[model samples]
Each structure stands twice: as C-alpha cells, then as structure tokens.
Target chain A: MSNGVDNNRRHFLTVATSVVGGIGVAAMAAPFLASLRPSARARLAGAPVEVDVSKMDEGERITLSWRGRPIHVVRRGEDAIERLGEIRDRLRDPDSDSSDQPEYAKNEYRSLKPEYLVMVAVCTHLGCSPSFHPDPADPAMGSDWPGGYFCACHGSRFDLAGRVYRGVPAPTNMDIPPHRFVDDNTLIVGEDAEVA
Target chain B: MQNKSNQGGGTVGDWINDRLPYRQFVEDQLTGYYAPKNFNFWYFFGSLALLVLVIQIVTGIFLTMSYKPSADGAFASVEYIMRDVEWGWLIRYMHSTGASMFFLVVYLHMFRGLMYGSYKKPRELLWIFGMLIYVVLMAEAFFGYLLPWGQMSYWGAQVIISLFSVLPGIGEPLAIWIRGDYLISDVTLNRFFALHVVALPLVLIGLIFFHLVALRQTGSNNPDGIEIKENKGPDGKPVDGIPFHPYYTVKDIVGVGVFLALFFAIVFFAPTFLDLFLKPANFIPADPLQTPEYVPPVWYFTPFYAILAAIPDQVGGVIAMGLAILVLFAMPWIDRHPVKSIRYRSFLYKALLMSFAFGFIVLGYLGLKPATTLYNELALRFTEFYFMFFIISWVYSEPRSRNYYYGAFAIVVALIAVIDLVRDMAGISWIALLVMIAVTAFFLLLPAHTRLNESKPVPERLTS
Candidate 1:
C-alpha cells in the first residue's frame, strides 16, 4: 500500500504544480496592489490651491479648498488677538511644542503673523471640522469661553490660533499647513515659497 | 490484504477515496468524531458562528464585484449597489447584518467557554487561537468599515488610526506609512480595501483552521466540566460521548434553523432596525472637512470604545482600551479556580459574571452617547468594575465560611442603607427592599443548598 508505483513522477508533478500555483497567486495579487495606489486624478487634485482673502472683511473667516481639505484663514480682530494672550495658559501646548506646524508659525499665535491666522480647519482629535466661534459670548461653550474653534464631534476645543485646550480629547494642536502670503491680501496653501 | 479489499467500497467511491481520502476526512471530522450528549443550548453558538462566517464571505465576494474603493466613487457606488444592482440591497444588508451576527454568536460562544472553563490547561492553545481570530475579526471589521467611504467610516478610521500616533518617536511616521498619505484619503481607503478583502480574511481563515484543529485534538469540554475522555468504554470511545454526525449534526441543524429564522428576520424585514448595526451618518460621503455631530462606533465595538473615551488622556485611554481586550487573553491564568463549571463554583463567581455582563452592556450604551459628565462618570465606574470582575475572581476564588459570607452581606446592607438614607428621608424603596431580601436569601439559604448540591457528587454515568 505504501508503494505509489511511480515516486519520481509524483514528486516532479507535485513540485511543478506547487510552483505554478504559487506563481499564479503572485500574478493575481499584482492588480489588487496596483489598485491600492492613489489614482492620477486624485494625485493631481492634491496639488496646492490658491485663495483670495482680499474681499474677506476683518474679524471674518473664509474656508478655502486645498487637496480636498478645508484650509481656514482668519483675519483676527484686535480683540481676538489680544484675548489670545489670556487663553495661553489653558492651551495644552501653548508654545506649539507637540503640534504639527511649519517652523515659521511656531510663535505663540501659531501663525505666520499675529494679525492673520492660517491653519487647517480639521480637528486633530478625530478629523472633525470645528465651527468658528469668533464671539466670546458663544453660548454653547459656556461662561468664560474665549473666541476660538469648537469641535462638536468629540468636544475638542481650540483657541483662535488653533491651539488645542488642555485636557481635551485632541492630543495636539490642529495642523497648520505649509502656507505663505503671495501679496498683501493673497495667500497660497499646501506649499511654501521654496516648494512652489 | 483484507484492508485493501475493505477500502474498495465501490468503483466511484474507491476512485475518489484513493486520491483525496475524502471519506476518511468526513468520517474523522463528523461521523466518527465524538461529542458529549449533555451539550446544552449554549453549545449551539459554535456552529452558528461558522454559519455566519460563511454567509459573510459569500456576501462579501458578491459585494466586491460591484463595490468601488476610491473615495470619490465609493459612496456613489454603494448607493448604486443599493439602487441599481440586482437584489444588491439584500446582499449588502445580509453582509452588514452578518457582520453583527458574527460578533453576536462569537460573544455567546466565548461566554459558553467562560462558563465551562474551556480555556483550562490542555486547551490553552485553542483559546489563544480563538482570541487571535477575534482580534483579526476586529481588524477585518474595522478595515471593511472604511471601504464605504462614508462620514462615520472616515471619522472612525481617523480616530482609530490616530491612536497609533500616541507612541513616542516613530508614531507619527508609522501612522503616515499606514495611511499611505497625509490623512485618511483615497490611498487609505484603497489599502483598507486590500486588507479587508484579502489580507485579514486570509489570516482569519488560517486562525479558524488552527482553532478547529486544536479543539478536535483536545476534544470538547462539557457542562459537567470534567474530562469525558477519562471514562472510556470497552470500544475505546468515551462512554459519555456519541458520534458527532447523526447526533450533533442533526441537533446543529435545529440550531441552524432557529438562527436562520432570526437572521433572515433581520436581513429581510428589519435590516435597519434600531440603527445600531448600520448608522445613518454613514449614508453621507466622507467629508474630511466636516465631521458628524457624534462619532460613536458600532454596537459591537462600543464597550471598548467606551473605555477609550472614558479616559481623558490619549495615551492612557489607548492603553486602557487595549488592556480591556487583551485581558481576555489572560483568562486561563486569571481564573485559577480548580472547578471548571459555574455550577460547581460559589455564587460569588456567578454574581461576578452577571455584573461583568451588565457592565459591558451599560458601557456599550454609554459609548453611543456624546461624552458628557454623567455618562463619562458612569463609563469610568463600569470600566473599573469590569476589570475588578477579572481581578477579584482570580485572587479570591477560594471558598469561604458562613461568617465571611455574613460579614460581606452586612457590609453591603450597611452601604445600601447609607446610600438610601442619603437619598431621601422616606423609607427604603421597594426595589431596594427586594434586592436586600434577595441578597439575604441567597446568602442565608442558597449557600447551604449549593454546598449540598456540590457534595451530592458527580454521577457515575451519563444521564442526559
């Protein structure tokens, strides 16, 4: 019963089929792997976008699209800028130590300038877009609420500089994308001057 | 030889058996396999879980034929499948509902193991394999969740992926590598599709194979929590065991029937019942800029999600949530009680099991709500009790005297009285009174009854 009558033949056939099957599986996986890469159209759209902030009034905010993300640019009023100092102690990383931002924006304001703020609108906690509550009296935030961003998705709070408040679900401050001013009222997002 | 002639059953049967050994495989796994005759309704979940797995795989294959993985087309493709494809809605619902049912049956199956100490010494590998399957099943569910490219899918993936970044040095880079992009974009969706459809499923099937193989090698545990293999008949078979084919096969068919009735009731009639299995927020396309007002995970994941949300710090929350699942892996070591079945253990063990189950359900419910003060507090307390059930049961499973029981009861009653007195000047509520009475009765009478029951001794022969 142990005798297969043709041992050499059986071994050769087994090895051949095994090798062919392995090759076939490998070949089949190629298309699936190729499909997982981002497509050309998506890659093209991921390029930098330009925004016109000239018409945006002072103390007003505008949302611009860049690579399918919302880039928030705010022209802070004198009051909002002044209140940023008072809310510094409440910020988790007031000095931007553990935040995702460019080197030029590492100052206390977390922006290129003290007057204007540019940052991604998405919350760092879970990628929820926070609503802009420029008015300190916003009722949902309760008393002593400073003018800033509020994420209703998970109760993550951020200041006017997009600095996350301490003890929030958000681990760090919202990311400030690589951006620089092209002119007095024009701005470009998703690329700095060197990269552009 | 005589065996050679006996193997030649019929021309066609012999022809296939010579090549494949099909008959022997079936006989070994089913017809010749032995199972306990005393298996109860709790044992049905193992076979039911297998049925649900098959349903998920078949439905998922069909879904992949029409589903798109790209972000732009994924949402529209799902709607297209619902609106345009032939009976696509049913297939989709079956797959979705099958996901929940898979977890449902698995949880019950795990509970059966817990009740009977199925993870004891010889079966430790089997339990570890089972836990690995559970973990892979979770990864499969998570990866599949992101394929729809809906709002909840997007944000759920966002929150879960960011958990990796809580590590110190390479955390941020590792997260970017996983996403294959800066954020959860088309690349992330594509990779998740690969994982959900191919990679994790392969691992799950492999682990399931090992789980079954280990189970068959060790045989099965019974409600009596004793080794039936020790009491073999003259025929070299367990005297308490019967052939799995005609006996358990037929019984499992009945299980299948009852399970299908409930499963089809969900699939055909109330596929969207209660909105816990399939959230409405998932209907909208993934919007990176705008997150949903609330982002609770599905019902199966809410218990762990509650644990994650209950903590204030990211790293602590991640560790706690991880430990909640990983704790089950240490069950064999944690529950050092010699007795296998809950029936033989003291009522304290039963009470702990009951409290753990309740705490799990309450945490899941709280996880569905937005993180608020009251809900968060409750979640935190429940999470503590959840862990305490494991710790206390492990450290204090030894039997105690009536004095210890009486002392514990007095302490509990005094605590309840203090709380009641603080609540209102009115007399104790009827609910509290009933609970107190029930506790007193359980402590005073049930212990004696249980002691007598344990002392009554195990039957010399199988009775069921």
Candidate 2:
C-alpha cells in the first residue's frame, strides 16, 4: 500500500478533484441562470409608454397601453370628484392609507390632481380590467352607485378615487402608477414629479 | 447466456457490469437500500408521487403531440383531442386526474414527514429538496392549466398574475413581462406552454433526483420516530431495517394498486364532474373582452387563494399567501422537540396539528366560493388558525401526559362531528361532506400517543 501511494498525495488529489468538480458544476449552471432574465423584446416592450390626455372629455376615461398593461386616464368631472367624498365611509381604504400609490398621490383622491385620476386599468382584485362606470345612476350600477370603476368578473367595485369599496373582493384601491404632468394636458404615465 | 464463466455471468447484467458498475448501482439504490420495517400506510405516498410523476410525463408527451398551444387553436384543440383523436380523451383525463393525485400523494407524503418529524437533523437537505419539488410541482400545475385556454384558466391566470402586480412600482410591468402581452393571449399561452413543457419539468426532475440522493444518504424515518441507525447489528446494518427490495417493494405494489384504482375511478367515472375537480366555466374558450361571471382556480390552489382573499390589503394578502407555502420549509427549525413523532408530542401540539389541517380544508372551500361577507369572514378566521399551528408547534414542543392528548382528541372529534351534522342539515355541497369524512378519518387514524396503546412498536431487532 505504501509503495502504491502515500496519505498526503491522496489527500491533495481528493482536494484538487473536489475543487475542479465544484467549478465544473457551477459553470454548467451559468447558462440556466442567464436564461431566466427577460428577453430583449420583453425589455424593449417594458419601456415607459406615453399617452395624450389633452382632449379627454370630462367624466370620460381613456385606456392606453403602458408596458403592455392598460393605463386608465380618467378626467373626473365635478360630480365624480364630489361623489368621491360621499363614498368615503363605504370605501375599504377611504384615506388611501393602505393603498398602493405614489407618495404625492396618497390622498383621498389617489392622484396628482383632483380632476385627473391616473391609475392602472387592472383590477386590484384579480387583474381583470375594470369598466369605467362614471355615472352614479348608470342602470347597471343602480341608484347610489356613486360613479367609479366596476369589475364585473368578481363584482369588485371601486369609487372614482380608485379606492376599493368596503364589501368588494378587491382588497385595496386600484394601483396608482407614478405619473407626472409634463404640462396641464400633457400627461406622462410611469414618471413622477414634485407636487408643490 | 453463458453463466458458467467465473469472470462474468455472460449476460446483459454482466455485459453492462464490464463497462460500468451497473449491478453495484442497482444494489445501492434498490436491493441493498435499507428501509425501516415499521413503515405504514402514510409511507406509501413517496413512491406513489414518483409513479404519478411518471404518469404525468408520459401523458404530457403524448398530449403535446396533438394539443395546440396557440390561443385560437388551444381551446378547440382540447375539444379535438376529446372528440376527434383516438384515445386522446383517455390520455387527457389521465394527465388531468394524475395532476390532482400527484398533489394528494405529495400532501400526504409531506404530512407523514411532519407527523414523524422526518425533517429533523441530518435530513434537513432532504426536506428542503422536497419543499422545492412541491413548489415546482405547483408551478408545473399552474403553467399546465393555462394550456387549456378555457375561461377559468384565462381569468385564473389573470388574477394570479395580478397578484404580482400588487408590488408597488414594477409590479404591473413585471406581470405584463411575465404574460408577454396585455392579457392572457397567444403570447402568454405560448410562453406558459414553453415553461410547462420544458423549463419547470426539468427543474422538477432535477430536484427529485437530488431529493432521492439526499434521502438515500439519510435512510428513512420510521413510525416509532426513533433512529434505527443508533442500534446496529453485528453486520453494521440497522437492527430494525429491512432490505428495501423485496420487503418495501412488495408493500409499495399494494399502494400502487390502491392509488391506481381511485385514480382511474376519477378519470373514467367522474372525468367532467365540475364540483369534484374540473370547473364548469373552463369549457368556454378564453375571451379577453369578456370576463367570466364567476372565476375560481382549481381546488388545489384554493387554500392560498382563500388566504389571499381574506386579507383586506393587496400586498398583505400576497405576502400571506407567499408565507403560507414558504413557512413549511422552516418546520425543521420551528419544531425543536427531542422526539420525532407526534406520538410523543404534547396534547397542545397534536391539537394544533388537527386545527391546522381542518382550517386548511375550510380555507380551501372558502377560496372556491365567491368572496361573500360570510365567506370572507370565515376565511379570515381560518387563516389565523392555520398560521397559529406553526407558531404553537414551535413554541410548545415539550412533552405532556397522554391523558391530555386523549381529552384534546375527543373534543376535536366531537367538534368535527357537530360541524358535519350542522353543515349536512344546512344543505352544504358534497365537498363539505368530503371534508367531514377526511377530518373524521384524520382523527380516527392518529397513531397512539402513549406507549401502552401503541399498536406497532419499533422492531427490537432486524430479522432475516
């Protein structure tokens, strides 16, 4: 046994082989790790989208694609803004305290301005885009509806401020993306600004 | 076959042995693998999970041969397979039913581990690997469900993906990137198809391989919850362990027969029972413009979904759901009791385990229902009970008297019976009845908590 090999030599060989094997295994895993990241097309598609809310009529909502997701830009009318106050008691997050919104938009309205309510069109409940039901007395919404968005999929209702209704399946208010007004009518979604 | 030769048997086994240690490999994994002789009914699920996995892979390969992944053709293709392709319905049903049974077997397997404390020292890696397999199995199930492109599949995917969008800034964009489109469209279906067929399955197989390797290194935990290795025979073999080949192999064959009987029953007799497994809304093709009136995931995902729905905050619900699954990995550290089996655990621990199991079933049922006021309230209550089991199991691991456990068990059994009776009279769905039966069986089947009542004690010696 001594003539064949010594203990020191066996120990050195074992250490050498283990180190080499470890490196080989790690090298084999590199490509799989690299494959997990989003592809070039996905990254390009994720670039911030720009929408023009300039000609949007009062109480009318326009949905545009931002990062391939529907972005709701609703120009709230005076009636809609007033009704937001009425639905305060009935909202799950009336103060927007538990809502997911930019810091500037964390008020009752959950937006940069009171009139322009910018939010992700997707429902907070399950991602189904909610239909814009602005009229309080819209036959489908019934009387005392207090205009907002309604998710027909699971009956999750939200007020005009994007605040989820108390009895609705949606937990919090609709997500408010960070958006800054390039100007009064020129609205840039997905970019934040300093609100004085 | 020239078996007379001394150097080799001159057969295929010898032929392979000449090139590689094929016989040695078989011996190491099968014939020579030592398992405890005290394994019982709960022990069968590990092998049964492997069998269902093989069934899935085989049926999946055939389904992919004809199943279309495109949005327009995906729903129609499932119909075509059901009606046009010969024996395609059988293959499709096998895969579908096999998915449910895979979870059924795995949950029981994991429960067996929990009951016996199989995740204890030296076997931590084995448990983690098992957890990884469980998670990947869920991913596989989720991705595969999208292939049907039915209404439930589409909206269910939508709701689940939206959970990711609950994240503050990048959430919405991230969800879109995952879907590869604005909604669950052809791009989303195609990507999910790629993941379902290629990515997740490979990870699953790799994890399972490691899981087996780790389990082989540690041997197996027994019903007695004692380490068989501590008491060895003169030949350095575990005193109570039997060679896994003829003993457990034969036992596992019985498990396979029983499992297959139930699996085939679901496939052949109740393939389209919406309440049992499949959802009725899934028959319609996916329509992005119109959302289904009622949308719920398959039964397996309902517990987490219920927890998700119970929370009033979007991010909070997501976190709770995530924790519900991830918390299982911490069981090893959480349960610091010296004993491995619940047989030696305190009464409180046993009670906690029962409550946790019952709450899980209730949460699952509530998750399937629409978020009515009553359902949401009940879900929230059960979620609290569900999470409390883990916390209590960890904090109170000290042993207590058997009399206390018996009292706790009696109370629980009585409570379950009362609830079952009330729900029955109230005209609850068949699912409630099924849960009642499962709960009754769970309580009735509990192993003895004291030495005197123990039906099968750990073997004192390994017999030939």
Best candidate (score: DockQ): 1
lDDT (10s digit) by residue, model 1, range A1-196: 2665687888899999999999999999998756544556545767777788888777799888776678899998888888888987787899889888998888878777787898888887656688888888988777998889888655678999999987667878998999888888778887764532
lDDT of 1 by residue, B1-464 (tens): 55563566558777777779999999999888998889999999989988998999999999999999998899999999999999999999999999999999999999899988899878888999999989999999999999889899998998888888777788777776678776788888988998899989889989999999999999988887878888999999998998999999899999999999999999888886688888899988888877788888888899998988776666767888999999999998888777777766665667767778888999989888887656765676677667666755564445557676566556555644554454312233555455554644454435544663232245555557
Cα distance off (Å), candidate 2, residue B307:
1.3
| Error in Å for residue A114 of model 2 | 13
Kindly give the stretch of ten consecutive residues in candidate 1 chain A with the minimal lDDT sum: A33-42
Candidate 2 displacement at residue B311 in angstroms: 1.3
Candidate 1 matches the true fold with a TM-score of 0.82
For all predictions in the order shown, the interface RMSD in Å is 8.0, 6.9
Q: Candidate 2 overall Cα lDDT vs. reference?
A: 0.78
Candidate 2, B1-464: lDDT as tens digits = 43443455477766767679988998999888888888989999999999999999999999999998998899999999999999999999999989888888888899899888899887889999999999999889999998999888888888888888878899977886787665666778898999999989999999999999998999998777877888888998877888999899999999999989989998999986555467787888876655676677788888998888776555767898999999999888888777677766655456667687888889988887866656755776577557656654654454445564455446544654454344212233355445544543343334234332232333444322
CA shift at B31, candidate 1, in angstroms? 2.0
Given candidate 1, what's the lDDT at residue B277?
A: 85
lDDT of each: 0.81, 0.78
DockQ each: 0.21, 0.19
